[model samples]
Target: MAISIDRISKSYGEHKDVHALREISLSVHTGELFGLIGPDGAGKTTLFRILTTLVLPDRGSATVEGKDVRDDFRDIRTMVGYMPGRFSLYQDLSVEENLRFFATIFHTTIEENYELIKDIYVQIEPFKKRRAGDLSGGMKQKLALCCALIHRPKVLFLDEPTTGVDVVSRKEFWAMLQQLKKQGMTIFVSTPYMDEATLCDRIALIQKGSIMSVDTPENLLNKYQGDLWGIRTEHMYKALQDLNNFPSVTECYTFGAMHHAQVSGLQMPAELHNYLDRKYHKNIRVEKIKPTIEDCFMQLMQADEREPVPNE
Candidate 1:
């Protein structure tokens, strides 16, 4: 195993009332691309911080490559690369300078590890003389990733690596991760974007400081136990409101141009179509659609409850 976490928990303040992580247990196999999928305020970042040796867990334990996170933090820090959600590079330093600084701190030189970051580094090399603060969001993200990889860490922890970048940049970043995985690196990433969950080998859906589900993205989609439909009408908001008010509607939320709905009881799509058409004078289109990762995530979050992991 590359990563092993056992009932890890953390809280803030002297009162320790805020539970950032609640008995979280997980494992990441060597060379696997694992994802922690959740929105903001979930325990994804907290768990990443613990695994990266930056935060102490109040209870339980975690290890990276068999080294205890707390006891071997010094060693763990040297072997892991971390890219926080926010850009933390020196705004005053040039891109090249920032990369060099991180490499030197890891007791390695850029030339020694340049091969590890060559793909990502070359994109920013032209702007090496430019200040990191002056780069565009996408460029800055790639630069930050290069700096993180310069030391050739065994495991990479990326917390929302593409949160603010453009769509093209997001795609490029995932490609880089795929390349890294091919090179036998263990990557643990956390993202709020449900679309990215399907790209991972496995994902842990987290919410309110707890994990709601942990499995392959396809499995989650396959296990969704609700009738879902995509709806479009003259007034999107009004349509959603009216749909929610309907006794048969269990959950209704906006998704892109259409609103997705789950019915309270089993009902055929044709019956739903007729009911909507009768209720509203305007034509309402309803189509049965396959559930996406976002749909499954919304359903899991709506439950707001985590299933207990059996004791081993």
Candidate 2:
């Protein structure tokens, strides 16, 4: 394994009551592109920090490339590259200068590791002299990734790297990751976007500092156990409330322009259409739709709420 974690736990606050992570455990294989999928404050950053040797877990143990995180801080630090969720590059430095700084700190140079970051660095090379703070969101992300790769580490940890960037930039960023994976780097990245989950070889869905499920995106979607319906009416809010009150509806939530409702039986769509027509007397459309990763995540969240995990 490139990374291995065993029942790790952490807490914050003076009373030690805020449990940030609860007995979380997972593994990433060598040269694999794995994702830790979650929203903000989901313990993704804390887990990344612990894996990169920046913080210690209150309990349990972890190893990176067979080196214990607790006992081999120096080795781990040298072996892995960490790009935090927040932009941490020096604002005063130009793009080229920032890359040079990171390379120098790692006892390497851009010339030596150019092959590792050429694909990413080329995108921002025209703005090499531009200050890091003045770059656009996409350019900033590219520069940060270049800095992380300049050291040419075996394992890479990126925490929510696409959070505030534009859609095109986000796409480009993932393309770079795919290229890096082909180069045999073990990449562990986290993101709140469910669509990005499908791009990874495997993903671990997390919520409120707990692992809800871990599998390939296809497998997770395949495990959705109920019929799904996409509903659209003139009044979305009212339709949502009405669907929630229906006895056969197991789950209902607004998804973009349509409301998705999970129901007990396949024949419920016609019944739903009629109910909406009689109640609201407006144009309504309800169709059986395929389940998505977002649907799978919502279902897992509901299950977790129904049976809360005890704090360690």
Candidate 3:
């Protein structure tokens, strides 16, 4: 296994002890592009920190490349490259200097690992003489990636690497990741973007410190259990409010330009059309639509909320 986490849990606070992770268990295989998909405050960062051996989990254990995170942190540090969610490169140093500094820390020279970062480094090479702080968001990200790969670590851990990057930059970053995966390097990345979930070989949908489901994006979308309809009207905000009052609508929420409502039974669509007609909605459209990963995530979260909690 590239990484193995068993029943890992973490909490913080002197008196209240807020739970960050709830007995999370997962495994990633060698050279697989595994993703931990979830929103903020869902314990993605905490889990990454544990796996990277930066912080200790309050309970349970984890391993990276067969080296225990607790017992062999030194070994794991040498074998895994990490790019945290935030940009952490030295703002004062030139781009090339930053890369060389990290290379020195790992006891390797950029010349020794040039091939590993050639494709990524080339785009930012012209700006190598510029201070790291002066580069654009995309350039900074590329530089950070070059620094991370300087030593050619076997496993790479990227914690939401594309969070603040521009759309084009995000696309470019993922392309670089794909190139790395093809080279037989293990990669475990986390992201909150539902669209990016489709790019992974397999994904684990995480929410509120729990694992809701784990499968390929296709499987997860296929597992969607209800007839979903995209409701469009002139007034989107009002339409969303009306959807909640819909008798057959089990779930309703806004989705981009339109609102999506999960209705029960086949007859619900016709009934919804008539119901909206009575409300005098213009250009009303109620059509069955495909569910995206975000829809699946909302379904899982709602189902979890509906589940009755056991008494202590």
Candidate 4:
């Protein structure tokens, strides 16, 4: 295993304390691109901080390539490259300076590890003299990534790296990650974007500080048990309200241009559709649609309400 986390938990503040992670246990195999899928404040950042040795966990243990997070933090830091959610580089320093600075911190020169960052470095080299604060969001992200890879770390940790970037930048960023995996590096990235989950070799679906399910994206889609339909009416609000009250309806929520609903039982009859059609008093469209990862995540959230206890 490249990464092994056994019942890890973290929290913050005092009385009326907030529990960040609750007994979260997972492992990432060597040279795999693993993703933690969840929304903001869902313990993703907390988990990354603990694994990167920036913050200590309140309970349980974690290991990176068999090195304990708490006991062997120094060794872990040297072996892993971490790009935090927020850009923490020196604003006054130029792009080249930032990359060189990090290399120096690890007792290595940029030239010594230039080959490792060659692919990503090429994109940022043209703006090497630009101060980091003057760079665009996408450019800043590239610079940060190049700095992280300069030391040739064995594993990489990215916390919502593409969150605030443009669509083009996001695409370019993932391309860089794929190239790294080919170089035999283990990557652990966290993101709230559902579409991006499919790009990983394996993903952990997480929410409310707990893991709902973990599997290959294809397997998770295959395991969906309920029939889902895309439904839309002239009065969308009323349609949602009425569907939620229906005895046969298992899940009803707005999804983009239409409302995606799940029936509690197998095969919704035409008569049932007619009933909803008349109730809405407008021409409605009801068609069976393949469930996406977001649909699966919604189903998981509706099926459970238990909050994670610290280190359970």
Which candidate comes out best when scored by TM-score?
2
lDDT of 4: 0.88
- Candidate 3 vs 4: which has more TM-score: 3
TM-score of structure candidate 1: 0.94
Q: For every model in order, what is the number of clashing pairs?
A: 0, 0, 0, 0
What tens digits encode model 1's per-residue C-alpha lDDT throughout 47-67?
989998888999999999889
> How many clashing pairs in candidate 4?
0
The digit string of per-residue lDDT tens for model 3 on 1-312 reads 899989988887895267888888998999999999999999999999999999999889999999999999999999999999999999999999999999999999999999999999999998889999999998988998999899999999999999988899899899999999999888899999999999999899988778899999999999998789999999788888888997788899999988989877656577888888888888999888999999999999999899842221
Worst 10 residues of 2 by lDDT: 263-272
TM-scores, all models, native as reference: 0.94, 0.97, 0.96, 0.95
Q: Candidate 1, residue 286: CA error in Å?
A: 0.7
**CA lDDT of each prediction against the hidden true structure:** 0.89, 0.91, 0.91, 0.88
Root-mean-square deviation of every model: 2.7, 1.1, 1.5, 1.9
Error of 2 at 177 (Å): 0.4
Model 1 residue-pair collision total:
0
Tell me which residue pairs clash in candidate 2: none
Model 1 global lDDT (CA atoms, 0 to 1): 0.89
lDDT of 2 at 75: 97
Worst 10 residues of 1 by lDDT: 303-312
For 1-312, candidate 2 gives per-residue lDDT tens digits of 999999999999998798889999999999999999988898999999999999999999999999999999899999899999899999999999999999999999999999989888888999999999999888888899988888898999999999988888888889999999999999999999988999999999999989999998889999998888999998889998999988888999999899999887656567988888878647798889999888999999999999978855
